[model samples]
Target: MRFCMMESKGKRGVAASRDGGPWHVLFESEPGFPGTVDEIVRSGEGAFEEAMSAIEAGTAINPDDLKFLPPLTEAGKILCVGLNYKAHVQEGGMPMPTYPTVFARFNTGLIGHNQPLVRPTSSEQLDYESELAVIIGKKARHVSPERALECVVGYSIFNDGSIRDVQMRTPQWTIGKNFDGTGGFGPYLVTADELPPGCKGLRMVGRLNGEVVQETNLSDMIFDVATLISLLSEAMTLEPGDVIVTGTPSGVGISFKPPKLLKPGDMFEIEIERIGTLCNLVVDEK
Candidate 1:
């Protein structure tokens, strides 16, 4: 099943897609998509089931009629896993991690697919990292890897936008990565059931304009989703609406023969099997 955020009547809402139209209103306020989904999921697993039923019964409008929002909004915390892809580590001249390397980005960096990514004047080394993003459906802490899958609501595409020069200026990546709208995530959230078990062999590809730039499979992950979540939960509570970006594959601009960076008018698209593609354009900051 696919779920998306959209705007209608000057208000943003969460919506489900069926027969090319939005069915079942999941949310009704701007920035409330994730929060609304969390409420439903918490109320019971049957909540979504009931919504689907209503849609099938023609009680909801079709999807083609609404404006879309990023599948997730208002996540309590946006957790990012770094160097989880073998190729990405090697390209960045970093050694394979013995443990999950993690970081965090604030909500200000969050943006939806197809939205314009504004280039910051502070840095000219903008780059893109295509990643598989995970959305949490339940509160979890100190969970076992075997049980971690139970907490995942679904997956989506994420462009871990970065400013390479600023990022490398310091060991921490926060400053370079937290620019407004720099992090592009989501077009829709695909339920875990829609993905294959283990997700180890799914294909993920990144393109600049129309050219394929990064390509790899989940099999290349140094720390798979389940283990990463289990490890993180050990450190802090993972709540509903929290997000985990599972790192990127190789081929970021910084790894080019001569580094390349995003400039105004650049476009990028990331496609992950089962989750759909996320496309965005770059524009100069106003």
Candidate 2:
């Protein structure tokens, strides 16, 4: 089942649907439905199953009637892994770290499908990093890689847009990666049941204005979903809706001979096999 959180009539609602079908609002924030996506996610896997059941019995709304919104809720954590791809590490001229290069992204930085990624006036080196994001389904802690996948509920695409100058300004990459509206996180949340275990062996690509800039397979990740979830859960509890952006593959703008910086009027897309494409427009920050 494909689960999504959409906005209709100015209120957020939880909807479920099959691929190529209209969405059914199982829970809306209006008067009679459940709360936000965060609330449903926090409610655990049972909520997801129940919502799908309801959608099956209810009527679905036209896709045009709803506006896409970032599927993440404020209560959820956004943990991103950087340099997990060998080509990316080599292209960025960095050593292959034995550990996952982890980073953080706030909800404020996330935007939905078809939205504009803001390029701040302070930097012209805005770059794009196409990554696969896993959404946690249950509580996890100190689990082994073998059983790590049990906690994942679904998968989604993420554009880890960055401001290179600011990202490299310090040893830590948080500041540059946190600019508002830079994180493109939505379009759809494909359930785990619909894809191969750990979403491995899938081809993931990033296109800038119709040109393929980055491309790789999910199997190429230095640390797969199971590994990252197990590792991160060792010290911190991984709860439902907590998204782990596995890592972006190589071919980022800065990795080019000169650079391929994104500017206003440009379009970018993150596409992965099985999962759908997530496209966004680039616009100047006002």
Candidate 3:
């Protein structure tokens, strides 16, 4: 199933569906019901079954005219990986690491579909990294590679927007990647069962102002979703709503001859197979 937390008719809106097109509402701020998409996810399969019932009997909403909120609730954690794609690592003039280069992005930095990515006044080096993001549905720790995928609930698109200058200030990339409102993460969460195992062989494309700037088959990743999940689980417990942002492939703005960073009035888009598009605009800081 796919889920989106939105605002409709001045109230909290929740929409979910197993297939495509029109989505049915599970909750529009109904009393004593799951009030948010994350809550519905946290409710596990029981809530999903109930939502399916509504899909068959409830009024549906078209994708248009719905305002999207970041799909995550207060309990989510965004764990990102860097340079996991072989081509991307080569473009950056770096040797392949034996392990995934991991990083973190605060949930506060994320914006939903159609939202603007605030370009901080300090730098015009904002760049886009198109990625596939996984949302974990169950608690998992010390999971093995063979079974890591069992913990995933759904998949979504992400633009790991970066401030290049700050990102290279030191070895640490945390500050550069955490600028408020730079990351784009939501609007649709397609459940795991809706996709092939680990989303392998899917095409991921990144667009800048309607032009394709980056494109790669997700199979190019050095470490696939299952491996990353297994490795990450070794240290921390993965819980419901926890997000894993699989790294982007080659053709990022910074990889160009002169570096094609984003500017005011520019738009960025990340689209993946099975999942939907995640689009955002960039605006100059006031």
Candidate 4:
């Protein structure tokens, strides 16, 4: 089942669709209705099952009537992987990592589909990164790669927008990655069972305006989904609603000799096979 969190009549609700079919909206006031996507995920499998059943019987609403919101508005943790693709690493002149190079993105930076990606006035080096996001379903600690997929409940798309100048100013990337409203996180959260295991063999693409900028196959990752999850769990407990943004492949703006950085009025899109496209308009930070 594909799940989308939305707002209507000034109230928050959830819409569920089967393979991009008709969408059924379940408002928060309904009986047995779960809370926000963040709360539902943290509530565990029983809540998801309940939400599925409730949403299935809800009122069918026109897509345009709802305001889209990130699949998880209050994600407990947003851990991001960096340079997990060979070409991305090579382009940045970084050595292939024995372990996933990880970073953290705060919820403050997140925006939902159709939202504007804010380009801060501090710099004009804003860049786009196309990546697949993994949503955790259960608590995991020291999980093995073979069993790591079991902890994933669903998948989503993430555009890890970056401020390259701020990012390069420090060896640690958190400062640059956490700018307000820079990360594009949603449109829908496709359940794990709906896609191939580990999303392997799927194509990931990024576009600036209508022109394709970044494209790659998911199989090219230096560390696959299961491996990243397992490796991450070894250091910290993975909780439900925790998102792991699998690293982007090559073709980011900075990789070019003359960067293809974003500016106000530019539109960016991140698309993954089987998952829907997440498009955001670029606007200068007010």
Q: At residue 172, give the lDDT of candidate 3.
A: 92
Q: Give lDDT tens digits, candidate 1, residues 106-194.
A: 87787887788878877788899999988888889999999998988778889999988788788888888888879998888877777
Model 3 Cα shift for residue 280 (angstroms) = 0.7
Superposed model 3: Cα runs more than 4 Å off = 26-28, 31-33, 55-58
Clashes of each: 9, 0, 0, 0
RMSD of each: 3.0, 1.7, 1.7, 1.3
- Give lDDT tens digits, candidate 2, residues 180-212: 889998788888889999898999989999999
Q: In candidate 2, how many Å is residue 94 off?
A: 0.8
Write one digit per residue (lDDT tens) for candidate 4, span 1-286: 8888898778889888876678888888987566778887888877777877778888988755678889997877899999999999999999889988899998888999998999998989899999999999999999999999999999999999999999999989999998998999988988898999999999998999999999999999999999999999999999999999999999999988788999999999998999989999999999
* Model 2 stretches astray by more than 4 angstroms: 19-21, 26-32, 57-59
Clashing pairs in 2: none
Please list all clashing residue pairs in model 3, or write none if there are none: none
Residue 38 Cα positional deviation in candidate 2, in Å, after optimal superposition: 1.9
How well does candidate 3 score on lDDT at residue 170? Answer: 86
Total residue pair clashes for candidate 1: 9
Worst lDDT 10-window in candidate 1: 26-35
RMSD of 3: 1.7
Candidate achieving the largest TM-score = 4
